[model samples]
Target: MTTQQSAIYYPAGEIEEFLPQIGRVVEIKDHELAVFRTSDGTIFAAENRNPHPKGGPLAEGIVSGYYLYDPLYDWKIDLNTGLVQAPDQGQVQMYPVKVENGQVWVAL
Candidate 1:
């Protein structure tokens, strides 16, 4: 796990405010990130940008299982590792997320 001590973590919002399988974009300074809560109740955070040629709007992308499928081209990115899966080679910045007392915090 990435230590929370290395960087400041900002509270995005209450965890319950985000709908399941929907990615919410959170901004801290100039960084734009997509935060997601899976249907099974797992939380993930990554860059809002998609790496594919025509893919974009990651926050509005579809969440399926453990991956966030890019809306433009259907490129699936692993939410757990931020790895762009198969045929795509690259990664989005994955932020360390912590939920404490129902609040979601992202380490930026």
Candidate 2:
């Protein structure tokens, strides 16, 4: 049987609160998410934990263009696709984000 998952969107914050090329950690229920706004104004969300064995927090990661570079291991993870860049092998969980009436919303 196929199970359907209904997404629940939570208000992350005001759109202006997220600076471009910066990762902001937001907690929704039991999930910790790292929300990012690219220089072009596109918003993306991903799991705040890095996939590396020694990695821990991704919210403190550096945001460059469309990818997030984990400071602990310098693991490059694509904010849009959640895939670690070449030479690295792992993926983070990505979430759907949207802006409504100037409010940033993230769905999981």
User: Which predicted model would earn the best lDDT?
Assistant: 2
Tell me which residue pairs clash in candidate 1.
none
lDDT of 1 by residue, 5-69 (tens): 67788888898988999989988779988999999988898988887765466899889899988
TM per candidate: 0.89, 0.90
Using TM-score as the measure, which candidate wins? 2
Assess the local accuracy of residue 57 in candidate 2 as a C-alpha lDDT between 0 and 100. 83
User: For residue 84, what is the lDDT in candidate 1?
Assistant: 86
Q: Model 2 over residues 67-96: C-alpha lDDT tens digits?
A: 888878978898879999999899999988
Backbone clashes per model, in order? Answer: 0, 0
Least well predicted 10-residue stretch by lDDT in candidate 2:
1-10
